[model samples]
Target: MSATPQPVVRRGLLDEVTDRILAHIRDQGLRPGDRLPSNRALSERFLVATPTLREALRRLEATGAVEMRHGSGVYVRADLSRLIMINPNRLRLDGAALLDLLEARELIEPHLAEAAARNASDAQLDELAANLDRAGRALDEDAALHTANMNFHRTLGRLAGNRALAQVLDSLIDLHDQEQRHILTLYADRDHDHHVHLAILAAVRGRMPVKARRLMTEHLRDVRDVVIRALEA
Candidate 1:
């Protein structure tokens, strides 16, 4: 008798396809504006259904990693500067716009950090610590590090134990990601930034609410200065 054929394991369709495509692009070192294979071709190659492929592509597009043209094809979109949305109706960027947002963050985030230091439970602190570790690792890389750092900030907000505050912080962070990435690209040194983050973490871990508050306020101020200087130059 002939040996039985092996059964192939099917992964989670949409998520797996999305991840695989993203990984392929990264591993292949595909540049921004590189055209992706057609939907039908990609679907055939990946053995995923057309709908699943479409969903995967949609996710990429939503994340500012890909762009689709009606008469053209999908092109990689890697301009993080253009990714930030300050005003929906405006097509231009002004320094004031970024400063305004950062000012708001300075007003809210330091107090939130203080509150988190005061109220965070052991489990919550542990989670925040773990996320910070990941952020430290990613800081050496370019795009990936920024994404991870963004996630770290979002989680930090959540750990503050205020749902409303967390939601607002998340929205602001999301809106600022593009501009943040742009500014950081100029002056960001992973090692230095990581040390600053470590300092903030230490204060938080020590449960010195006032110290943590002050440290984070300083950190934001430094960030604003760096960003403004870069923009001015």
Candidate 2:
């Protein structure tokens, strides 16, 4: 039998270990609410130190993947949808941090869009359309529109089917989700952003990877400039 592929990291970090543990659960056919092995046993199994294992377990708990009780053991949560969503309270973005965040988005998001164009299934496209539809109707309602906008991008990330990429982008973008209304104000044409999203979705749906990449890059560039303006204001 062919050996399973291993991750290329020299030693797994907390995030890597978190993914591994989740995979282990799935492979073992452990149902939601099933108890995971004890910390000592899990540490030994993963070849990680106790402290490192605890850190990984804590990360999983934060993402709602597992619940850790003070006296009780860990168990998987029934809802994993929370896994892809980031906690806004954990964000501490100042000027420099915001710049770095947007810079990273500019670098990564275009490629993600290209990949989504190549890899997205029909259902993913439908989800994108649904998000866009919701956003379009909520333009007058700032908070709702911003939320729909954020979901739209996150859905795009999922469409790429790259869990690592989706997780990183979610963390980075969630930093700005709360600030979206302020940043989105920089667009002179209120509906322009929605139109751009549609164009990107059409590119992805049409299997135009290059167009998808270009549109996504331009979208990020616009957003980055707006964020800079907002920070300066």
Candidate 3:
């Protein structure tokens, strides 16, 4: 049998244009909050139609790299230097897929919690404490509480001192942010969640790796159980 040749993949013009626009932003040293040229100007510069340029801008806007404001020009909203990016158009996962996501987190996050307990500095521990405090205050406000809770998990991942794992966790968290908020409503015990986070933080701050890992594992399992029940009901 003859060896099979790989199919040649061609990049779309839209992707090319998007890359050019991002390059222009970097080449011009544009930072977050810096305004880019007008749409007409960018279209002319990229030699693409107005619609094509708008589409490209919308793609960037969706990724948090830039913000498109009506009546005002496009402004940089994020650092283009990120190593990992989330899927901008990812749809909500079904019950099975959601369970898979939680399973993946359950495996990875507790290990990260252990790493954080071993390696985190006093400053990092204090920051985690502050985040827990924010979560405590936001217990009655769904949106704020969700943000704070997610931040705690994300921050703990980064404090683990493993860049690759941290980036992976970041993408995972960003991908399922909306679903996590929905999970919060399903779980429906804000005080309990806040206290669980506090307990995890205390373990991390105390430099108790075994305790931190155990607490994190218990917390995630509880969340997974909540989701399973919700699906069952």
Candidate 4:
């Protein structure tokens, strides 16, 4: 009889270990509030050292996955989505920090657009096309247009193929969007935004990296001016 082959084993980081453990529970059809194996048992089960297992458990607790008791071992509490989102207002950002964030974006994003122009596949370009269509439809509605535009930029960031850069840009953009929504309350000028965005999109579509870079720079400049003018007025 043929023996069953062992699966290839891989070592994972703390966060990945936590994700894997949670995934195991889900795949096994474990119910909510199900008890995970004890730390020592889990370590043995996964063939990981106890310290690494402990680190994973700590992250799960912080993220509100499992609850600890004085005597009882850790048990799954609930899903992570139950954790509240942060209120932007409560986040402390000083003027210098805000400037730094903006400058960082300026440095990172222009090149990202350039890279997207150079490297994005036809499928990815189609995604951008879809986003632009949504933006065009939302043009008359400033808030909706703003959302579409935000998504378009985020899609471009993703096309840059750098996960860490994209994550940082997402966070900064989220913060900026929250602040700008309050400051730029007027509905966006549909006629103007459509043309400007389309021009940028065209450069990207044509694979004109330099032109795409220029268009992106101009678009950001216009946005910065409008936001500053609105704040000052």
Which candidate tops TM-score? 3
* Top lDDT hit: 3
lDDT of 3: 0.87
Query: Which ten contiguous residues of candidate 2 have the minimum total lDDT?
Result: 79-88
- Whole-model lDDT, model 4: 0.74
Q: Write one digit per residue (lDDT tens) for candidate 4, span 85-181.
A: 2243456665555556667777778888888888898899899989999988876676887788888888988787776777677777766776666
- Candidate 2 vs candidate 4, lDDT winner: 2
Task: Report how far residue 96 has shifted in candidate 4, in Å.
Answer: 5.3
**What is the per-residue lDDT of model 2 for residues 48-110, given as tens digits with 9 covering 90 to 100?**
877888878887787678899888999988645444555625645567877888899888889
- Total backbone collisions for each predicted model: 0, 0, 0, 0
| Candidate 3 Cα misplacement greater than 4 A, ranges | 1-17, 40-55, 62-64
Candidate 4: residue pairs that collide:
none
Q: What is the C-alpha lDDT of each candidate?
A: 0.78, 0.82, 0.87, 0.74
Tens digit of per-residue lDDT, candidate 3, span 135-199: 88888888999999999999999999998888888877886678778877766688887889999
| TM-score, cand. 1 | 0.61
Could you list the CA RMSD of all candidates, in the order they appear? Answer: 13.2, 10.2, 7.4, 11.9
User: Which pairs of residues clash in candidate 1, taking residues 3 or more apart in a chain or in different chains?
Assistant: none
Select the stronger candidate by TM-score from 2 and 4. 2
Off by over 4 Å in 1: 1-93
TM-score of 3: 0.80
